[model samples]
Target: MSNLISGRLPAGVRPQSYTLDLFVQLAEKTFSGRLLISLKVEKSLQTITLHALDLIVTETQLCGQEALVSIHPSDETMTLTFPETIPPGEQQLSLAFSGKLNQQMRGLYATEVQGETFAFTQFEATDARRMFPCFDEPAIKARFKVSLNVPTHLTALSNMPIVEEKKVGNLKKVTFDETPLMSTYLLAVAIARLEKREIRVGETAVAVWTLAEQVSLGSFALKVTQAVLPLLNDYFDLPCPTPKLDLVCVPDFAMGAMENWGAIFFRDACLLLDENRSSTATQRRVADVITHEIVHQWFGNLVTMHWWDDLWLNESFATWLACKIVDQWRPEWDFWLSFQEGKAVPLALDALENSRAIQADVKNAAEIEEMFDALTYEKGGACLRMIENFLGESVFREGIRRYIKQFQYQNASADDLWTTLERSSAQPLKKIAKDWFTRPGFPLIKIKTSGDTLKTLHLSQQRFTGKKTGTDLNPWIIPMTLKYEDDESIHEQHILMDKQEMDLTLPVQGSLKWIYGNASEAGFYRTAYEGRTAKALSEFAAKALHPIEKIGYLGDLWALSSRGDHPISVFMEALCHFRGDASRVLVSEICSYLEILSRQIVLPADHSRFAAFVDQQLTPLWKKCGWDADKDEDDEKRLVRADLLWALGSIAQDEEILSELPRRQTLYQARPHSIDASLVGTLIRLCALSDGGKRFDQFIEKLERSKTPEQRDHYLLALATFNKPALACKLIDLCLSNKMRAQDI
Candidate 1:
């Protein structure tokens, strides 16, 4: 582990000669208040003789950045006088500032969500510099001793476990358990009007806290947190580390959740739930998110990262671990399979795209947060699954044990992990590590059924291998898992297999049930089953497989379907088989593919036949869930269904439904304010074709001038297909020059 604190500094962190090291935070809030700062370097080692200290601070906000407000100098320490009545050398001095948080920014800033007022902190960026200063980088680890003073009723929380809580008059003061020295971003929390609940996970007492006003939502979070904790404790081979754990909801939060040692921060929907009518999707989300943050307490909070370049190593493991645990414990939810289609495939494609590489350093700060994209979360997880495949489960678990034991509470790089595994297994891991981490795309593993013997092989594009052979061949450290029907077995082994089209003999006889080439979904290799082997996987997915594999089964079909290489009937048959209670996102993705086929394939040949086939595909499913076109259901669900209806109605020429779409569009567009929704575009596009040029122009004018973030997506869609794409394009340009929201996604 390199220096998360002392490594390359961010912009403005280091000035020409002076340096600032941010440490220590004291929350002196009345209901709501904050502190932000960094310590500055004043005297040189050669000049001071380790005697007196002299430092200056400037561009300041609130308090000074010293560890203690007033420190008595020892015989070995130094002191300096201020140029002004209350100053010293302003150039290099420790500075800490305190203030009431601005609600708009949520953390250091404030945020207002729905109709209720809720305040929480989301200071992961340079805002931590604004909150409290000490070496702010992740590598610059330091033990944190945080103290808070709030209204007697306002509960105080931090990364550390609470050691003391005292009520003095109307104000309550709390001192927390000291945190293992860690980076700034990992230290998170929220202070507000709260209603809380608690449970015991083993010997540790854990709690769920949220806005008092959100009673039903907060209660649901309490259950999910309590249930997932013990299960994870068993799987990870680590007990819940903190004596007390806290999960708090901030509706206005920018990210889903922050792993703050004992205190984790989350967005509203993730931690808060509606008991009576929450959709199936909402329930699955609660599980996935809660499990994700809890795992981070071990992976991210305990074992850290040395630099931002390997940030994916942190996120990808948590993601894979989260979905895996959820699927094992709550198989009914079937969330991982859904993720395979909507999230994983798209990520693999993006990772292979011209602009991206699997492992690259942060070029500049402008795109750091934005860098947390599809590749980091999806493709990275797939790649790690591959690593598990090659290493073998028993050895892989041991490697993790050694890796974490060696680096607990300290930061680590990808190489640090690779070295640990090499030492543990006495095998050269560099070849496989380089192939997976240093490349730009995924690999295609081809499995064929030849006579009674099943043969397997590997293929990749020229760029990935950097090869000059006729087949552009180069060896890859392939980690593959296989599922076959003839054996009724799932081979979760890492095939350190190398070849330029070398065939392999297998133990299979009749057919193959499935092939998880990268066992445990670890690697980024996609499987291609030839002829009859593909048929058996479909049959297994059709009957025996659960939601996760069904989604993967559909994803495999869709990949082949989109390339126009697979037959439409075979694709349709696979879609027909996915009747499980998948996710709304999965259902929506499937519906989209069918509609795309109708518009691009079937419709052009014979419009009436296409319409009939689409109506056939959608009609039964339409009434099955969200076809309340008359608006007689939940708002969020209605909106989700409305998305599907627009596609169906537009293609079928259902003018009755399509004509009223503008009014529905207007209603959806009109939210808490104009900027609260992204529905304007689809509604506008449906109107464009339904009412021709007249309604299109009226809708166009509204978007042309509307300035809220609500209009951004609509404007973008309008920009994509309008009479003049450039007109919409230029307006987007203007908006770009204007401010953008951090929560637009």
Candidate 2:
């Protein structure tokens, strides 16, 4: 078996830089490449090994001298054994190889868009071996100079700006500028008949590209890119490394976006927005995704992780910073509330017995693929935000500036970041953050009040799990922030809970009513209290708490209720009390949790009764948001309206909604463009719930006539919303036919 633990190349050799010359034949779906990689040899060795897969190594040379080459196809590697032991020094290894472009979306692949095939690459998490022969690990960061030969009709792009392009006999030879020191996974290339819209922000040139017919939809991405780059440059306190940035909307992309140095690649859905058809929510997503990829240009591309094990270091900062930056850009969106909702995901997922730690063990390719999960992205980001809250935003910002400055153009580990923050804040981060990173599960802080005066507070923690898994893991160093009953002081009791139990004696016990931990929903843990305490906090959540805190209270109640640690009545009571006061995000989270409880917890025989309960719980929100038509509504209104309608249609199955389906279907057919963009999906789902075989056929017709990418996505989602078994079966059969696009399917 191969060395799965490290996944490292053999000792005695390391790559410094690579010079690649590639000839891509789009029609034949194949490419031939010549590579000359400079290496820093440390010790004398007979054989040099590097990662390469699915490529025919035609020739090899060591130190410009002939060498015998051997290929290990099963292990995705190659070895060149020279006639004698190579001396330690700088040396060049030359190779010539050819490989077919893969249909699989990994590595150098061919994607057909509108009947025209285009070549693209996705090499993150060890797939770079499928592209060329090299040391493909993240720490082996190297500068790359690439040259591509493509048909004259196509435009070629890479990780760097094009330095030279010329036509020769119906073919174009495109040479890109040498890239900064970056990982092989960040290396990218695309050759297609594309169009771009460009803008200039400061000295940096930004451009967004897409298919020729959809170039107009690229404007929104371009606008956001121009706005966020300068803001990010200012925030990181580091100048943009590259003079130009390019974002390409690939017709078929496995991930939302790949931050490939200067040239970022995005799935079309994430980057394109048609003003006529897309909703305010779609625009927000476009901005968020664009800002995310651009921030990666600094965090992930400029200063990368030292190894795949520290991949969370690359994702977490970008994810958190994207929310922060977008919130700053649009304060009205209340993005932090949405951020709180996003943070709740990891808390719930990590509480499970099967969940992984943030820094997951990626011993092999399969494990590496799984690391890009909720824990790494959501939990990691939440941890950073919690640290920010504790250390103060100004101090955290300074730490980030120092981190980028210290590790610019170099790989850094998780400890490097903590060390930098500790330096900035002069706080003991290592002690507080160690368990958070190393431990596999999150903690639940239990609160109980005792003493004759009911003023004594007791707090303890144990690993949280769905089943009774027992307390096997050690306690976490939780950063707890608590607010007492009716105490409006911003500087409440903040403690670093390094032990299993903590007891605090209140100075005055006369009227202390309740205490809540992890206030503002900043920390990545759950909290529960004793009977009287939980009830008091539940009531407090109904009136005095911040919206995020209320959301947190509801979430913890649901978790405790589901585990039977707390009564489900407590959850329902809190939902009823907070319904009118909850924000759009809280409403959305409530609906989401109720949906899960209905599916998993509610008995099959009690499904109807549970649905009625949900209808009653959501009634306040439905009345507040209302079912009405309005123009020029804000994103919050749009989102809230959609969520309420969805809960009403799916859970309640109200007769009014069922009766209106036919009329709504007619309106959708006659003036589909006039339907509220946010409610379109909900309306289609209502139709599906109402015996929608005929409506399904009409949706297919609309899908065929979709003029914008957003319309296509909406139609596809509508088709997928069929709940009826027969309709779902028919939808699957339709997907197998030629009508559906492979990417959409």
Candidate 3:
């Protein structure tokens, strides 16, 4: 171990290219590799330091001669000392090394499914060192030519298309073409007995690979990839960089997905879909995750962040752009509404005192790992969406296209993106966006009525801290859109609320019926209205606002009430106006907020009354959705039915719902495929919660019989909901047992 102060390697020497060859033995769980790295040294030096971890280097040669090697396990680095000074010029370094095929799901690792073992690589952050010795950092970009020697029965894949293959006895040597300049973390290799469904999207060959038995399940993902690739290309005004795009479904994956140059890796649940047994929710997830990795092909791979500190640059852009392209492909999905619902998670997390900024300072590998949280993906994405609204869509699109073209195949910082956008749109963006990227919490805008007329309104901004009043005095440059209606028509006015307080006069002919802040839910900030304004907006929200705006309206009320800024009755009152709303996205938000209120605020003595209130609000919606599925029903209708059934059964505890559960459970057990896919998990959970002891053994049996990853997840989560204490302990034991995958636990 070396006492290196900095987590980064010294700046004098860097790699220009890597030729990595590995011989992997999955049965023996070991791999041996030989690496030849082309380096360019800036100045004369006696020693060169690079990154390596858990690797045994058998031989080291610099410029085809012997060199002294020193391994540092503490900082995961290796130094090679030459007998003579190496002047400032290009040099070649080669090493022969061996390492274990670890089970920790990092670097070169093995995953076992059933009785079969496969090798895969997950090298993001810093684990690339564990595979082979190189300068493993995002800023150090290098081209790679990878070759793998594996069993002849398996298929090997890497960052590029296969260039050559030859058989050597029981093993095959497969060499891939040279990849574009990329970070080491984005280099991937996978070896498995796989089958693929391939399609051609323009010049790019897109394929989804999975186990032979699940090849049919890759159909939906294949279609989604075909649809999204062209949309992304058109949006970026650039063609796909890679000639081949492969989406591999790993059986045991630690992350939802990893965007590895042309070879993207996803968990089974994210990439494989059984249409007959999969829910609309699963379909949406498959689309979103697939599109997200595709977007990264250009945003993160072509133009990467210079350091881990600006990781949000890679993730946030991918998150925002993926939604944009997917929405363009399937407008009927109402994907932005789903985005709004997902935004609440990070909004809540950001309100905590201990929350870190979107662009926090990251030093070591552990700190870099911590940056991949909800704040980086969700909050950062929401902020980007807000900025896009501030700058019109066309302008934002042009700015992004320019940014990609200018920084393609290079490294960039967050400020570089902002500067490019500012130049393209001629908008003063950095002044407004700096606070959002560097600050932890968002603002809460308060709307107050001025005088007796309905034309004038006063607005004030303050940081919103959950559960307490915030004292942070820094003001954000907030973009706001006010929607107000008169007797004749509705109108919109955009404002830049850059101060602590501001007053605006509505441009209405006569009297204003109501004014709703945060129209279209465009801004990331929350809004609070005065009593009269809140009442008027509530009355007109269902009719006047968009479905997403209606959700944002109620979501703000609930958030405000939860923090004691207003009474819980205020949110309850707002719920009444939305009782007749039919959008599944809005309904889902309402159900989730109601469940939270029931758990946190409702008194034990008033439980029955609260239940009755829930029944009154949702029963009619459920009746409209009905107990069965329609053959031609839209996805939203199917989703709404599932939401209503769950809320009515679990939260409201409606007698009718409770009575129907036993019959549904029996039907599901008899013919699970015959049941409505959206209702399967709900039925399983309702049965478990209602008949805990009797259903425990039944659930365990069903879990053992679960065929798909989705079914297994549903059963596992359902098992945790059982009420008995002994059953809870048994569930924990099951989680720790060999039956569960380490990733799941």
Candidate 4:
């Protein structure tokens, strides 16, 4: 290959369509393929270059003549040098190549389940080159026609449904229908001995595929899809992109899920649910993962991102919209409250000195991989939520609908989306949203009152960093809301804070109890209240604030205290005000914060004091919920019970919880399903930690009998919790051995 030094391929020729035929040999772990690509040559040239990695090309033919091929490993490109200069017109390039079915969970890989080998593909973020030779960039959209030859007993799946199948001796050739114009990264294929459970959502055929023994485990996922698919269709104002949709649960997957056009791939843990064994958290996770991938069929598959730099446009929209759809479907689950707690992760990451922008300039494969972090998914989603709250939900929904309709089956940039939204709402969006998209950090709003009555509020904004920096920072155009309680009633005021500092005078008849910025936890910024205001808000938060707002309040204070903006004592003092709160979301957050403090901050000499403090806060709630789940209890109570059990047994070291572990373990051993599914894992871990080497063999026996993926995970994690040094070493060796799946290791 010619020594091209650029990170991206030269753009003289583009692929219009591809016809790929492959013979997969699962036993030998290798595959051979012939690729016929229809190309549109933009300029007359003697040579053409495209991406290929770890593949051997046996033959190359162009225009019915032999073409010279050279492979460049440095840039993962294959160059074709023709005998004569090709004209600027349509042409066909043919190549026969072979590659190994890699063990790595990317490209075309092999995974073993129940002593059977299956081949799967994961080609996003530049791994498509590892699978086949092609223009493996997101902007080069092309139609694909794929045909796979596999053993007769195996089933073949791709981006489209199988159009034809023919048996030839012991092998079968499966040809899929041609796909819509799409990016190469969205192409997928699977060959496995699989069984599927199918259903119809509107005119679209939907199925969940799994191994035969686990086929029944997909019932919950099927139910979730049956509800979520039509909701998204109506919301987007479009039909499903493809006639059929398949959600496949693979034994080995690198990510939570991959939205590969019509065929999505998920890890078994993310897709399968054992109703008798899986916890409420697992059910919630299954719904979230399924909904997230389905949303991609419209946002990321139908309307693709132009390049890697705009990856957030595809991922953030899917992340934000999935939460919206799932919350609507299961409002009783209080899903948005969980979302408010989840935002704390990205907010903390953004406060660091080395944080990257929501939209960073990606130059190479490594940079592209770096883009798939908390900043892109969590922070980006939070930014979109802030925008939606500002623009009004209906107005934002209309703008998104227009965006998808305008750019379906094509590539678009972040600017294209912003422009479409601006036109839909007739609002100036680009200027207000530019900093959030391009800047590295978020703003921290500090409040100060001028008058003794506290009606006149002065707010200032600056870039918040975990550590001090000398660089000058630019101001963000913030959409803010203040929720305050006066003597008469609660009131909300909305403002667009575009300047460095702004002042507002509240019109109140009586004294104002408190003013809370970041109302409803909608904005993507942190709020810092003055001393007396912070105290009063914390004292009255249960009565005055929504559950979601309470989570946001605690999360912000926890983050600020961790970064040394305030003392740890301040957060500890605030925790005392919520002792009797019944919201599971708030209680769970409090437990998590206390656990972290116990592990990372409390001194050994003062550990008992801290444990006593935790017991004082959670014991009454634990007594109310009890160790066993009540038949008439709500999901929130069950979840809160699980959280409290974990905190008391693991962190607080409460003697009542510790002494009851043996009895709980005995009861679980007697009848596994009799124990509360949500608390089983916590009980196992605590028992293992408390019993140590005495019951190691018994725990091992229980692990060997584990049937579901969730059970296996709980056992494996419990095995690691044993406090003996010898047991720890044994666990290390067990992980290094071939007994466990790569994902578990």
Candidate 5:
């Protein structure tokens, strides 16, 4: 007991031996005197000697039908007991365990797509041990020399460049150029029977590896990076350093994408594309995510945090940096608004939930994985964006650069990140960061407007029981992006983060029409202005000053109304004004909220009034905009057609509307186009509404059988409409469980 070694397990991880027993009573058990294992590592001089000592393998998970593993330790070098069960191992294991060699994982994983097999590994922290035995901790950073015993027909790629490849027997031993000493997780390997599509982005050679069945999708994967990489290099003042960049799409990907240094692993949908079949939104989303993961090569993988608690340091910084580059890369996309609305809103929601805080830890790791939802990733990312808005870009970038350099090849906490910012600028960045990350919920400002004068007030979490009190104000250092309209004039405030109340005396400010809280992509909360402000936003959302602003306003209004904040009445009023001119996404959200409200409160008699408003609002757009209804089989025509049909179907049960489904279906097939997520969801709703699941399943069964992960995601949504909360939640749970693979959902 005196000589035993132990370390506290971080959240989301456990020690290899968690429950060790050491007592006289346990003497009968397998010998255990520390069972100390040591390893010597060198990147330049390829070698690793694992001194297994006496660590007995009890109830082993390794050495099954796939492969066998055993280790016999000696003073000279531990001999790996490899299994001859697999044919490749018989020939390859001798060289794979070549004394001057190593193995690593993470950032990429290769698998068989169709008949083509590829090698890809995701070795984040302890998982890297699966690839090869090592210290298997972030703190013990080391450069690795990898000697891969791959099949002769397949190509092996890793971080940095490939230095040599030689054939022996049926196996090819490929050695990679040495990488900088960094965490084990940054070590990536992608080997496949893949053809490469290469591009020169400055000094870096960008490559896309695709299996025969996926060559088409892989072609479009790097286009987004081809454009954004250069922009980011200029912005970050750090060129993409790896000699080669490779992206491989795996059919059975568990995560969206991994930012492996030099080699990246992506879900098929993220990398593959066909213009004829995909929607404009999907293209934009692809670009945005590409920007996000690529930036992580520098921010997350290249310079990573030491431990799981500081995971936010790597993730949130990358999350914000992606938005920063995306803004400059694709100005037309206005993806930042999506970050604010989609990312920030959920963070605020989760912070308000029972277990708040961006960096929450529980006794076990399974709990941590559960928290790794939209709130942790997206919303946490958005708050990081807000911090940048407060600190300014030059300061933020300098802070980031300094932080990376300071902690390069090591782990870092959120505090370490703020320390750089604090040193760079004379600001209390730690306090500012803590206020947002450690605190629960977002700041909501409630301002009262009167003619020619506006009385702005902070929205403290005060109980409103008739009598009012703005006394207990915890004024968030909020960067409120406000749009002040004076007559026909528009004024924008880029900075004004901390204030309980702002009193502005503008000439004839009479009844301020639209006052949004988040302002632009700068703020991190929703606006709650009902009377004239809501009316004005509803009227002006389509032609708003900025597309991003329009996106935010729509999201805020919808979320506030959906959670029963004000009333369903407000949504109806706002939808009436917004129906004619707005983004299709905005229109879709409004319709979603209206349907929920209709189900919850709107009586059958009250449905027509609200239903008519929906029809009138969406009609002009359906007629003139991209979402014109159709029954053609053409994918392009059907996508927009499906959206329009869903809007119509929501108002169905009306005899005339019910009769038009067959007509719409026919027209949709007339001009055949590929179906999309929204369209598929719409078709499902229509089928369920018309008691057409059996009929719907007839068409959908084939698609389901041949569906990719992305398509299967939509199938789960159709199942989500259980019409009962308990049942809907149960189905959601079922879909998430391991019983059904996430990709098959």
Candidate 6:
């Protein structure tokens, strides 16, 4: 048995394909399976070891000959020792195994919806062995043919389209076509009474599946995929490999979505969208989530990663590409800025000190699971953006197309991609990629500009430690860009800062109104200004600048302030300019930052002063949106108003807002449908915060009597807001004790 957990399978034998036939007993919460594995032996071997977990192997055979099976449950493996040596040649191994369908969401698990039981599978980064034993590592890619026997009333789905089905009395046996060569982690299955909404894109058939009652809500997701998949195909210059793509919404999903080769599974919250009742934010999220999973059809599923260490290669590319595609699909959403604010900035902040690199080292199952974090998704995308901006998008896309064509249906490492990109762009991409991907921290660029007559820009780089002192860490190959004040010739200068400090000759004019370092926030590094450049940024931010630039400046300012490089007052002064900023995303971000400072950092004695500051800053927005929803308000206006109300009413503890909640609560309970859907959550929370245990009990009763999912969720959140530990514990027990539905859990 292999000793390394979640590592590569031994090199002597390689699996070519798997044929699995399973009988699923939903009532028993168990499954029995027979698997035939085709293999190619590189050397003569007396024994072969394969991964299997929580399963009882009844018998084993090699090439139709009985073999001795020794099980080592600790290593999740079973070793079969043949009496005679198996020579280097093609061979087949077969096994009959049975395992319980556990409740843990890791492997094949069953959930009860209403009164019926449904089974689903989630096996990423290591849990596939529990489903059906085979070579479970990412490098061992193979074709899969799956057949399942279940009750005749249920429908079964796999990674490929259904090829055949037969019924015997009360059970149906369903078979799926052979899937493309892929890793075991991408294999998925769901057995339920699923209703599907279908669409066609060229030769490909796409469908969105959910419960029968929620089938109508799946239309928005289907529409999104139909509109975006073709654009992605055009962008990649490559077609999806499968003829059918099935998107299923499961009630209990571990993550937002899984990028299975052909069958993608999403949480109900992410996939189901009712256009009439959904907000603008909900629409944007649905688009982003669907686009992200679809792009993975090519980027992640077609061209695979060799190991878990380079998992970022799949996630980061998809993260950036999702926004790139969505921006083209819906320009009014301003997805690029959303990407910067949501992904890039937060990741940069997370990568300050003691943060993992883009390409992390994963040794065990737990480490591999933990690697699917912000560094891999957000920072990884930011670094990719940095590379793309430096290499030019045309060249970047060209290289990507070549890379996909070269490594289709195979596993490749980060270097394989860098080398391919180097071929197209003729840049030192391998060096640039290694410096950022291997390091644990990000660089902070400090630019010092002096002399009005002839300005000289001295730029220095160091690892940002969130402290005042600098660390002796290795420098990065920064693809840093600088934009001067409105001179086309000097508008942009691309520099690769390989050393600690370098001097550049800037063509000075007048007093240098502004200098945009990390221009357009293209680079992943933070920038700090000194001398006249600092003054220029302050003045320009106060008067004229794009909303994105304002976001970038404020983000960098807050990051620097956290590191003691700048004062908190500087951030406050910069934020004052956004008092009248109409961009909903930006306004929400400002409100979030204020709440963070007040809740996480400020002392108890300073609460009154902090509340006053928040009230003053948000008063402009409050005046615009008002306490109640205006007649026929814009979608963005409604979203901004709800967010502001949550911040001001709850976090800021506004007395007038708190005072009005009891009246609103009584009115809402009398006529629940009359209250605005957008502000009802805030009203519930305020009700709990204003009146303690009595309001909480009332909210719980409201939750029990609620008919709709939205109101139930709101009431649950309000019930969770109680400050008393005993009450919080009671709410926790109610959630975990199975009193709520599985979907709610």
- The 0-to-1 C-alpha lDDT of every candidate, in the order given, reads 0.57, 0.82, 0.88, 0.88, 0.56, 0.82
Residues 402-457 of candidate 1 have per-residue lDDT tens digits of 88778887899889988988887777887678876776665555565555444443
Off by over 4 Å in 4: 1-6, 468-472
lDDT of 3 by residue, 602-655 (tens): 898988999999999999889888878988988899899988988888888989
lDDT per residue as tens, model 5, 351-387? 3435366776533234434655665677678887777
Worst 10 residues of 3 by lDDT: 1-10
List model 4 lDDT by residue over 215-276, tens digit each.
98999999999999989999999999999999998889999999999999999889998986
TM-score winner between 2 and 6, please give it.
Answer: 2
Query: What lDDT score is found at residue 117 in candidate 1?
Result: 39
C-alpha lDDT of residue 3 in model 6: 67
TM-score of each: 0.69, 0.96, 0.98, 0.98, 0.75, 0.95
Question: Where does candidate 3 stray beyond 4 Å?
Answer: 1-3
Cα shift from native, residue 508, model 2 (Å)? 5.7
Winner by lDDT between candidate 3 and candidate 2: 3
The RMSD (Cα, Å) of candidate 1 is 9.3
Candidate order by TM-score, highest to lowest?
A: 4, 3, 2, 6, 5, 1
Measure candidate 3: CA RMSD: 1.5
Give the higher-TM-score candidate: 3 or 5.
Answer: 3
In terms of lDDT, the poorest run of 10 residues in model 4 is: 466-475
Q: Candidate 4's C-alpha lDDT?
A: 0.88
